[model samples]
Target: MDAIPFLPLDPLSILLLFVVGFIGGMVSGFIGSGGAFVLTPAMMSLGVPGVVAVASNMAHKFPKALVGAMKRARYGHVDVKLGIVLGIFAEGGVFAGKEIMTRLRAVYGDTGTDLYVSAIFVVVLAVVGGLVLRDALLNRSSRPAGTRQALPAAARWVRSVRIPGTMMRFKSMNNAEVSLLLVAPLGFATGLLAASIAVGGFVGVPAMIYLLGVPAIMATATELVVAFVMGLGGSLFYAWEGFVDIRLAMIILAGSLFGIQIGAIATTYVREQLVKLVMGMIMVVVLFSRLFKMPVYLADLGAVPALSPSLHGALDALSVATLALALLAGAGAILIALARGIAAHRRRHGMLEPAAVD
Candidate 1:
């Protein structure tokens, strides 16, 4: 293997990474696995190599995920056995994901790798985001606090078709033990996404909720355990391949630790419905972030007509703007929920203290 060229951090880039990391961490904490979706793209925008951006993001994730899992556990939301079972399978998927990335890089270089990752981002985010968003709209209730949503038809179907040898009970789901057959693919996909772009929670959490019948709150919390397991395993593989950038990883991790705590606590205040709504909305918004940049990669690879330099720059700018909006939108929603939660908590206790951001 050869020494990978790590991007030199300018003052501006360092500051940018710190801010992005904090926001990303907050999102991750609340949703159980989102920071990497933003962090990887943000690093790539700063002239970091495609593989290195992903590698560094994965390296930063395990510690943050560990913190998040522990925090959410206090709320009695985590399903440890379920998470561990899923994560072990996810580890295999991570290995497969790295192979896919490395091969793409070797053949078509960074442009190829970026194109592949960006395409997946667009497709996966759009489908999952749209589904969750629609579900939120349809399921709106008068209740303030979130309750476990009714199981989806798919989940019911999955639970009914029990494989005699593969059924395993999970406390997160009410009755029916899901089959290992179903879990294997979902876990693998989660790990694959985690390795590919360091954002597997998007898939893992939703699968647990809509397919396996886990409640939204429990799904988000339990995914952290899966994340911790996969992130640790993925980092070792990426580091061995000389893709991990320690300096970049540490900076992001440092900022994210603080943000993750806030995000985790915010979860306690908000309704579970808001969790799905925010996760879905952010993914839909972030989809544009990738769409705006996809043409540039295609043109670079001669897969599409060449773009004028000015247009290319404009597309990149638009991508960055959308990414920023996604972060801000997520943060704003979490904070609002936190404020409302705090006020409600106070009202119930008949406390005299004024409400404030924690």
Candidate 2:
């Protein structure tokens, strides 16, 4: 068997990883589930193999989620019961998704795995990003995505269904009973996405909000609960397979630990309309990044005619650069909001005891 491709990290790469992890932490803290979407792709951009990137990102995530969950819990944002039940099923999905990755790797090799991961990224981002963008555009400035409380038609329909043995209630859903059958598939998808691309929040948080009548803040916070479960479970399996690089996980986790708290705080201050806008744009931009990567991976797999070294290098650079810019774009919005929010809080409180409202 080929040696695990543990790329020797240089100073610049290590610094970049730290930066990515911090911003990713902010994303998770604020948005409730995503730093991994950016983190795994960023690591891959840094020459880590695709599986390794996902595995290491998983390793760093559980602790960050635990910490983030605790912080948000202080604000009464987390739904532990909902999170745990969904998370249990999500672990099963993680097992299946990781198994799929391993088999693909054993067959078509790293390039194949790269191609598969990039393909999933493109599809998921395109569909989800487009929907988010449309909602942001159509939504009134007065009512942000976060503050809208009335359930969508789908959620209402879901709530109306009464399965005798399968229904469960949640505070986030206003104590309405939702079916475990529905919850299982959603949890499975979240786990699969997390294992495949190192992100479940992209799928989980949004699903909770739009599909299950969850409030956006609660959905995001509760996703941290689900994330904690999946991250810990997935990390064990990845580590057993020798896919994790502990050093990389630690460096990234160290930076993200601080960033996640800042991000979680920003959620209280920042408006969700802007978050939705930036999030949609980031996904769309990253769609292009994966698109740029596909041909390169295809050529390597001999699924396409070979390209000149110059062309291959150019494509690779484009994919990495695009991924960086997309992630940075999202982080920039959060950071700017964080700065403004903090300033406003100090101005209003004058460093005295802060008020009780967001």
Candidate 3:
């Protein structure tokens, strides 16, 4: 295997990375998983290789996840037992994912690996994002006040099935009894996607909600535990190959920690429906961002006609802009929701005097 080169980080680059990290962490704290999608592409745009961007992002993820999980756990959101069980199985998937990534890099080089990752991003984000968005829109319009939303039909069906000895009960899941056999596959897929794209929460959170019957807040919080486990293990594997960039990881971590705290707090302020909305919105936007980059990768691999340098540059610029837009849209939504929630809370508490008692 050829040694992967690390890009030099100037002051401006460091500042930009820190900002992106902060936004990514904020989104992760709110939605359970998202920072990686933006961070990976942002790093690539900065000239970091695909593998190193993923490896470094993973290295930073575990610690940030630890902090976010701890914060949410304080609010009684995290399910430690469930997260641990799922994470244990996810480790196996992470190793499997790493193996596939290694082979791709060795055989097809960086461009091939980037192409593969981007393609997966496009498909997963499109399908899942569309479904979640549809659900969010429905909930916004049709849901009754003071009533919890119903689980999806698929989730209800899963909850009904009983697998005798394989059944495991989770207090966090309302003491729901589910088969370990069923849970393990979701964890594996989550880990595999995480290793491949640096954001497994895309699968993990939704699976917890729609399949495992966990609530949205709990699902998001619990995913941090899985992320921590996968990120730690994945980082070790990547670091062994000298692909992990400590400096880059630390810079991102610095901003992400602060963002994570704020994001977690925001979750307490907003409704579950909003969480789905933000996650879906970010996914859809990021999907387009990755789609824009696909042509560049295809041209590089000679799978398509060679793009002129100017056209390639234009496409690359557009891709980066779209990625930034995804982050901004997510952050804007969270901040808006948080602000509204806080104002309502204050009003209920009579924090503002009634017309100054005039």
Q: Which numbered prediction scores highest in TM-score against the true structure?
A: 3
lDDT by residue for model 1 (209-248), tens: 9899898899999999999999899999999898999999
- Regions of model 3 farther than 4 Å from truth: 351-358
- Point out the higher-scoring one by TM-score: 2 or 3: 3
Candidate 3 worst ten-residue window by lDDT: 349-358
Q: Runs in model 1 with CA error above 4 Å?
A: 1-3, 141-148, 351-358
Query: Cα lDDT for residue 333, model 3?
Result: 89
lDDT of 2 by residue, 27-55 (tens): 88988884887888888888888888889
Better of 1 and 2 by lDDT: 1
- Candidates' lDDT values, in order? 0.88, 0.87, 0.88
- Backbone clash pairs for candidate 3 read none
What are the per-residue Cα lDDT tens digits for candidate 3 across 1-358?
A: 8878788989999999899899989998998884787788778878787888888999999999999999999999999999999999899888888888888999988887788888998999988889889888998999887798776777778778898899888977689788888889998998888888787898898888888778999999999999999999999988887888999999999999989988999999988988999999999998988899999999999999999999999999899899889888888988888899899999876845765664
Q: In model 2, where do residues sit more than 4 Å from their true spots?
A: 141-149, 346-358
Candidate numbers, best TM-score first, in rank order: 3, 1, 2
Lowest-sum lDDT 10-residue window in model 1: 349-358
